[model samples]
Target: MLKQFCEHCGEETEHKEVIKQKPSKYGKSKKEQFKAFLSGFFGGVASQVGASLDLIDRYVVCKKCGRKKLENLGDEFQ
Candidate 1:
């Protein structure tokens, strides 16, 4: 239930939620590996040691003009 001001439509319009995955860094070097090992051993949080990263990119499309744009709608959007 997020409303955004659409430049294309020149008015406020309802937007839809869009989830996108960001490209993750490829490969972990030896140093990174050692750090992960140490963190796992000390912190005991090894579940996602080297998992690929994802980002939630919020976007809004003008229902009237169909213009797509990136928008920051705060935590509720996330």
Candidate 2:
């Protein structure tokens, strides 16, 4: 978390910056995926982690108030 001023909270608070990934619903269903993972331990976990790294949306969310500010990856972080 980074200390930043939140306009909504009207104070400086901790903010969580997250690089959003593709939605889970885009491919195999959660229930089915879980069952498939049960077949292999490390391999299954590794595959899941590797596949989900396709990130898109980036957001900085305030901890004090649930407000989100969109950020671009190309911009330098101040």
Candidate 3:
């Protein structure tokens, strides 16, 4: 749970982090098929840079009114 100001609620309320599906997958490699290896090594990772770029959206939804607000924390780190 997170505490944030919700415009719809007009007050500080509990918010939940929600990651919605990306708008599109064009030009991006689809999620690799799961593979299992029993010999010695485990399955191979799909990306060396971890998560895909803009593959999903982050939002903080108000628990009271169920309103969603975009959480743009990526700009801070960049």
| Candidate with maximal TM-score | 3
Cα RMSDs of all predictions?
9.2, 6.5, 7.0
Rank list by lDDT: 2, 3, 1
Which one wins by TM-score: 1 or 2? 2
Residue-level error in angstroms, candidate 1, position 66: 1.9
In candidate 3, position 21 carries an lDDT of 42
Writing each residue's lDDT as its tens digit, candidate 1 over 1-78 gives: 768788877878887656343322423787766665564455443222322112224467766777888754445422
lDDT of 1: 0.54
Candidate 2: residue pairs that collide: none
Alpha-carbon RMSD, candidate 2: 6.5
Model 1 residue 21 CA deviation (Å) reads 1.2
lDDT score, candidate 3: 0.59
Residue 19, candidate 1: alpha-carbon lDDT: 39
* Candidate 3 residue runs with Cα over 4 Å from true position: 27-53
Clashing pairs in 3: none
User: What's the distance in Å from true for residue 52, model 1?
Assistant: 10
Report lDDT per candidate. 0.54, 0.61, 0.59
Q: Which run of 10 residues does model 1 get worst, by summed lDDT? A: 46-55
lDDT of 1 at 16: 69
Report how far residue 77 has shifted in candidate 1, in Å: 12
**Residue 7, model 3: Cα distance from true site in angstroms:** 1.0
